[model samples]
Target: MATGRAKGRGRGRARGRDETQDERADRMWSELIQEVRVAQTGVQILFGFLLTVVFTARYPQLSQTDRTIYIVTVVLGASATGALIGPVSFHRLVSGRRIKPQAVTWASRLTLAGLLLLLATMTSALLLILRVATHGDYTPWVVVGVVAWYLLCWFVLPLWVRLRHTTID
Candidate 1:
């Protein structure tokens, strides 16, 4: 009798789990959707709040530089929202095409792009807020530290675990 890892076409691959291409794709798609949902909610709320900032009475009093930062931050937030939501539209349009594996790959790429955009949006927003509130030289330094923290939390630790815990299947 064959072992569990040898029972599927994915044997000898990455994690060496027993799953066919379709099964793997299905599982990945489900996981991706859950991740996207969380990101989408955050981006949507941030973008909505960003949209309201311009209407506030204090907006017109902001310096030219502050206004520019605000504009850039809003644009980044909008772009993040679009990319994060792209997978849903992509899946809906391509469903029943029997190309789920390919669809999942594209969706994952979109999700990654969305995450990077979200990171940019968040950092930009933070910078703008800090500059407005502090108007001090330390604001940029503080923003840099926060960005590093985000990178560590979002990418570095996960990558470290993936590198350290997994075997070379």
Candidate 2:
């Protein structure tokens, strides 16, 4: 009495989601867009704030090193914002092309790239801030520690879950 049909019963599907390839793509695209929206809001806000730093009175008082760090951080933030927003443009251009699956793949890649850029921007911003907040020698150590934490949370845990618990199709 073995019904080999994995249809409708949600069997033999990866992670028990039980969906067709197109269905999976659609679900994933929706999920990816939602995630992008959250990240986009954060990065856009951070980038906007970064853009305003040059107008602050304290900007001219910053050391040359700090200025360089600020510039790099701004560039990273802008890049992250672009990458995070790239998916929308990609989706718009490909909407009627009958390539939802391909579009989803590309969008996911862009989101990952955006996340990486955001990490770099955050690390640079932290370094600059800590350097200004405390002139002590421990500033670098604090930045490194914070970067490690971000890495753990942003990259390591998700990768571990994907590798450890995911089933291959």
TM-score per model over all chains: 0.91, 0.89
Alpha-carbon error at 69 in model 2, in Å? 0.4
Q: In candidate 2, which residue ranges exceed 4 Å CA deviation?
A: 1-15
lDDT of 2: 0.92
- Which 10-residue span in candidate 2 carries the lowest summed lDDT? 6-15
List candidate 1 segments past 4 Å from native.
1-15
Backbone clash tally (model 2): 0
The number of the candidate with the highest TM-score is 1
Local error of candidate 2 at 147, Å?
0.9
Q: After aligning candidate 1 to the native by TM-score, how far in Å is the CA of 120 from where it should be?
A: 0.5
Candidates in order have lDDT scores of 0.93, 0.92
